[model samples]
Target: MMFDDLDATVKALFDDAAAPAELRAADISFDTPDRAYKPAQATVNLFLHEVCENRALRDEARVMTRSGDRYTSRLPALRVDCAYLATAWSAQAGGLKAAEEHRLLGLALRWLSRFPVVDERFLRGSLRTPPQPYPLSTTVAQTQEGRSNAEFWSALGVPPRPAFSVTVTMTVDPFDEADELAAARRLHLDSTVMPHAALAGRVLDHTLAPVQGAEVTVVETGARTASAMGGEFAVPGLAFGDYTLRVQPPGGPAEQLAVTYAADHQRLTVVLSQP
Candidate 1:
């Protein structure tokens, strides 16, 4: 599902008229074997250079690729130089998108193509470590599991934390107009609720406030997932699944629900009753 979203986004971006056209343009010179392979190698080199030149990469390279002639500081410089050369070659011959997609696909084929390699071993080992920590004031998630840990540690080239899924069960009543009204007012119920949030992609034992199984489907997402620690079951790293959310009590009739999401951090409420 994650890869699906990425693939869609990349395809959409490439389809746009303004995005680098050369990236999407077909290679007519494929008849020449040397010309055919040159593009792929050029792109791979470009991606490698970008990764190497990044400040974080420079630090890691210092530890990974150490030599008397090539000091740690030179790592970033070398990578940038190499990438620039490749980028120039691609731009002069292939155009922008070709150069861009070449790098994009070189580094992230899953996003371009929907087939991602799904191995527990690779997932566990895909943690990325940043060259430096976020600002002291920034909130860093403590759990090193699933995709977040994979993304975080992969940046640093560290192994991903183990993967775990958490389920949050809640119940609401469609008959209780008063409680529904109260919850709607207090929780600011909206369209942003995931169709069924409990079966989302990540762990969220942190942010959710408990409710006995009821009639309405409960949904939540965004920063709340990470911030829902301490008082509630805040879920993290949801993998995309429909949840059998408990609505209000068994005696009540189900009401129509329409969830809408306007922004990245919109909050939602679950109201079982209608006006």
Candidate 2:
């Protein structure tokens, strides 16, 4: 039965030639607390031993828990997490010997060595450390029956300890504000540019006050409408059309003005007369 199952599993892998690229033979979540998984060495050893021993369980298998052990005695299933089975059983098909088994196990270990281990070296050697404390209370106790528990711990190469939680944060910069309302009203009307009074200088001092966080949005009818983000904004590359100009000053009232664009090369002066 075990041989048949193994044969079927191997055949299935070969049959599925176009497996998804995203499919992972083994997956580990860094954020998640360590789950008690069978060690590659132990899982391989147990499965091979079971096959050789012919002590296969007919029904359910006993699974271990953090709190205690449960009993069922079901035949063990192969897992990518416990990939040692690939080599162990592959060699076990022939005459079973220590040297051959060791060689296969070494290869499997090398293959799995690519993954990072949590605690590679432990200083507390043979101190007979009591069970480390865990955050969650689970049924899979330390004293689990059969080789599953041992295999799970061995795979991690570390005893079950505890899990942790973490958080990430980000900071945003405040917007800049500059413009004075007193300056907007000081400008005298110069030449009539097109729609409104045309001024000489780049800007009318009192006409435009120190406006912090002010955004200018120019909407062109029958054309594209664009908005100025952050600092200062002005309409450029504009063709003759009716455009709606909107300005929003931080902590102040919003102003919207409509103007018709003509081929007069006109300059429009925007002034906030009232404070």
Tens-place lDDT per residue, model 1, 167-251, is 1111111121221111122455544455444322221111333333332333443222221222222233444433333334334
The TM-scores of all predictions, comma-separated, are 0.16, 0.21
Off by over 4 Å in 2: 1-213, 221-233
| TM-score of candidate 1 versus the correct structure, residues matched by position | 0.16
- lDDT of candidate 2 over 31-74, digit per residue (tens): 21134432333112222111111122122343322323322322
| Residue 83 CA displacement from its true place in model 1, Å | 19
What are the runs in model 1 whose C-alpha is more than 4 Å off?
26-275
Assess the local accuracy of residue 5 in candidate 1 as a C-alpha lDDT between 0 and 100.
27
Error of 2 at 4 (Å): 99
